[model samples]
Target: MGESLFTKVWNMHKVKTLSSGQDQLFIGLHLIHEVTSPQAFAMLKERGVKVLHPERTFATVDHIVPTKNRQRPFQDELAEKMLAALESNTTDYKISFFNLSTAYQGIVHIIGPELGLTQPGMTIACGDSHTATHGAFGAIAFGIGTSQVRDILATQTMAMNKSKVRRINVSGKLQKGVYAKDVILKIIEVLGVKGGIGYAYEYGGEVIENFTMEERMTVCNMSIEGGARFGYINPDQKTFDYLKGRKFAPQGEAFNRAIRFWKSLASDPDTHYDDVVNIDVSDMAPMITWGIHPGHALEVSKSIPALNRFSVDEKATAQKALEHMQLKEGQSLLGQKISVAFIGSCTNGRISDLREAAQFIKGKKVHKDVFAFVVPGSVQVKKQAEEEGLDKIFEAAGFSWRGAGCSICLGMNDDQLVGDQVCASSSNRNYIGRQGSPTGRTLLMSPAMVAAAAVKGELVDLREVI
Candidate 1:
């Protein structure tokens, strides 16, 4: 039997099997950001050690950077300090830092791929949980804690346990208005929040194969939400085409050689997985998360799940979510009132996402009472959107067009929802207090769906508006 791509990549990066039964794996790319790198850098300073491979490590600021007014001496003192520490650390170690002044600066996950630093058959690590976003390039990428970040910074390797591989085959064509975001939400809903524990999800089948690179990234970006350590799709011509001509991509004869190596990393036809799951998305509809957790979701046309439908072990949490959300059981989320609409995040803040929302919302206006905004995933995406006049379309529709950053996605920056306001957001994670206010409610959906909700001041079927 052939080996899975996970196994192949793991073996290639395996430094040694530790006595504790964990493999010491060399990280091909180590991404860092302001929020998490400060502590790790301090640890290195305390230990009197320098970065083992500064060249392999990259730094950027996103989580705490303000999207609106991005002047120095950030209003949040702690955020300012963190950024300063990152700048100092990167400079001291001679590592590449994509500061705010550089156009390459944006979300760490977004910049890595656009610059061609992430590639197939490599091990990538970052301090952010969504580091799995890089897996869309057919690489083994996983998030690590601050201590683990320090370990990699000092030694260029970190210890990790091997995970079982599960093939998630999504076949058939997706229906109109159904998007990559909906497909992932459906996977999380069916597989349950904990279904992917101890496994690496290998996404395949006709639907995934036909998806664009940005779509694949959106799918892999939320792997952690499903409890998967990492997720990946096999590299193919699409992968090479996207990587070619990128800033850091190989050129000339080197490009050909790199392509051959990348293609070789793809899983064989008969590759065996520890488990397999098959899903057909031909009839899938746009999905929305009604409750706090990502798993508490259903089709737009479906009613919210009643407490009685949950298993005994799930009843308590279900009840808690419903009360916190101030929602009634069995109520359909369609036409639910929304006060805010957010269209950005590592999950759906790429140029394609912006363009999709812009095209759908063109010549339309945001609801009079609703507050709407759009944030690009990276500086490059922001520039591209402006060049394509997507920014003007959103602005004309009364949506606030902000600079690139994580923004309201995590409430780490100044952008956050007010008290008890329900928001239609394209970001991942609908957990309570995820958007700043403890009573603030977040309804997760695609950028287009968010656009629809903004236009109607309520959750409406995107298909009807488009």
Candidate 2:
């Protein structure tokens, strides 16, 4: 029997088994951000400690940094303080910081890949929940809390139990108007939000293999939402092609040597898995989150499922999401009125995402009542979009093209929904208050779908809009 990538990586990183039966795993790359690391750094300061390996840790600011009007001394005093604390801590500790002034600064998850910091076979951890985004490169990545961030900072290791690996085989080519975001949303709906507890998802099959690096990131970015500890794809030529010449990736002969090691990390043909799931995406359509959670979703062309359709344990959340969203059980998400449209986030804020949206929305005017904006995932993405004239296309179509940061994704910055407004958003998660306003309703969809909604000012099938 062959070994799974999870087992191979776990065994390679395992320092020892602890009394609690959890393995003390070494962290290869530790990512830090403004929000979570401040307190952790404070704790380390109180203890009179320095980061164990400053070279392994990287820091940036995303959450709480205003994408627009980014002058210092932000209106949100708390956000300003977090930014200052991160700057001070990184400077004093001699850790690399991607401050706002640098072209490298962006969402931690986004910059990691674009900068080549995330690599195959590495154990990556970050303070943000979407750190699994790195696993798209075949790395073992975890989203940790503040204390765990401190642990990795001081010791370069954290205690964790090994997670059972599940092989997810997604086959079939996606139809036009459907995209990677739709594919992952459908998967989450099928698996249920909590279905992945104690498991690591290894994505494979024709659909995933054919997907671009950005698309893989879209799927892996949501693993945590499904209760999975980590989600990853096997590294292949496509993965190697994407990493080539990247800032932090190996170059020349070093690159050739690294590729050999990276290729060896892929699961062997007869690898064992705790469970397996097979999904077909050929006939799927654009998916929309009608309820609060990512799992509470349905095809844009389909009507919302009645409460009776939910499992017994899901009925309460189903009921609450309906009430909060003010949606009827049998109502169709199609033609639902939307007041805002957002196209950005670690999930769907890449250069490809922008190009696709810009191409579709060109020559179309946004609905008068809808306010729409696009924030690139990173400064480099922003520069590329501008060079390609994508920014002009967006602006002419009545969408605001703003600077890079998390923007409206987490509602930490200035951008957010107001009142009970309904929004068509490309960002992940639609939990109540996820976009700042507790009553604001977020309908999660693909970047192109969000562009379609912006044009019509309502939820519409991408096929019809296109």
Candidate 3:
């Protein structure tokens, strides 16, 4: 039987089988950020062990960095100290550091791909959960905890159990107003939050094949949310084209050789999967999350589900979400008042996402009562958006154009929701307390959808606005 891409890559990286029945996999790339690496570094210091492969490790600051008014000695002392620790560690260990002053500084996930550091047929790990974002390039990428970080730093290998592979084939073309974000949200809703546990998702079929790299990244970025440790798309012409000429990509004859290997890394035509799921996106509509978790979602045209529709065990959680969101069962989310709109995160902060929102809101203005903002994923993305005048379009539309950082996606940064305000956001995760305020309500949607909400100050169909 032919092997899936995950099998091929995982086998290639397998160093040895441990007595505990786990594989010691050699990680090709190790990514670190300010929030999680401090304790790992301290652990290494306690052991007096040096990083085995410093050159393969890369560090950046993102989670705790304020997007606005980024002056030295950050207002959050804890955040500032974390940054200082990362700086000192990287300097001492000789790992590449993408500090704020560097053009490469931004979200670790964003910068890794832009610089060609995340390539096909590699095993990648990061201290952040969304490390699966790199799987868009056909790599086996997943998140690691602090102790796992220490293990990788000291030995350059991690103990991991092999996971079953599930083929998620999304067929048919998406409708006009729907997007990759909508596609992923629909998948999560169908599969349930725990459906993908102990499995790696291999996304394929007409819909995913036709998607751009940015769109693919957006989908794979949420694999963790669906309970999958990692997700990947097979590398093809589009993948090779995106990597060509990138700073860390191979050059000259080496490029040709690398392409051959990358192409071979794709799963065979008759590759076998442990399970298969097929979804047709032809009739899919723009999707939004009504409750705290990603699985508690429905199409924009649909109403919040009635309590009786849920399993007995689920009804209580559904009721709690309804109370927190101030939403009624059987009520459509349409026209739900929103006090804020955010369009940025590693999930949807690429140049294409900005352009999509900018083009939609070009002649429109934000609602007077709504506070809206845009943040690029990386410094390079920020520069490209400015060159394309996306920043001006957003600014003129009353959206705050901010610097690159993982802002408002989590409660770690200064950008956050106040009180019980409802927000239409393009970032991932709407769990309670995710946006700073314990009572803040986040409705996750596409950038274009968020733009429409910002303009109307309520949940409205992007199709109607366009």
Local distance difference test scores for all models: 0.93, 0.93, 0.93
Q: Looking at candidate 3, what is the lDDT of residue 94?
A: 97
Cα lDDT of candidate 2 equals: 0.93
lDDT of 2 by residue, 287-361 (tens): 999999999988898999878988899999999999999998988988899999999999999999998899899
lDDT of 3 by residue, 1-466 (tens): 8888899999999999999999999999999999889899999999899999999999999888898988999998988989999999999999999999999999999999999999999999999989999999999999999999999999999999999999999999788889999999998998988888999999999999999998999999999889998999999999999999999988889999999999999989898898999999888779999998998989999999889999886789899999999889999999999999999999999999999999999979999999999989999999999999999999999999998999999968899899999989998899998999999999999999999999999999887778
Error of 2 at 311 (Å): 1.5
lDDT of 1 by residue, 316-380 (tens): 88898899888899999888999999999999999899988998999999999899999899999
User: C-alpha displacement of 45 in model 1, angstroms?
Assistant: 0.8
What does the lDDT read for residue 244 in candidate 2?
A: 99
User: Which pairs, if any, clash in model 3?
Assistant: none
In model 3, the Cα lDDT at residue 69 comes to 81
Q: State the TM-score for model 3.
A: 0.99
Candidate 2, poorest ten consecutive residues by summed lDDT: 60-69
Backbone clashes, each candidate: 0, 0, 0
Model 1 alpha-carbon miss at residue 415, Å: 0.5
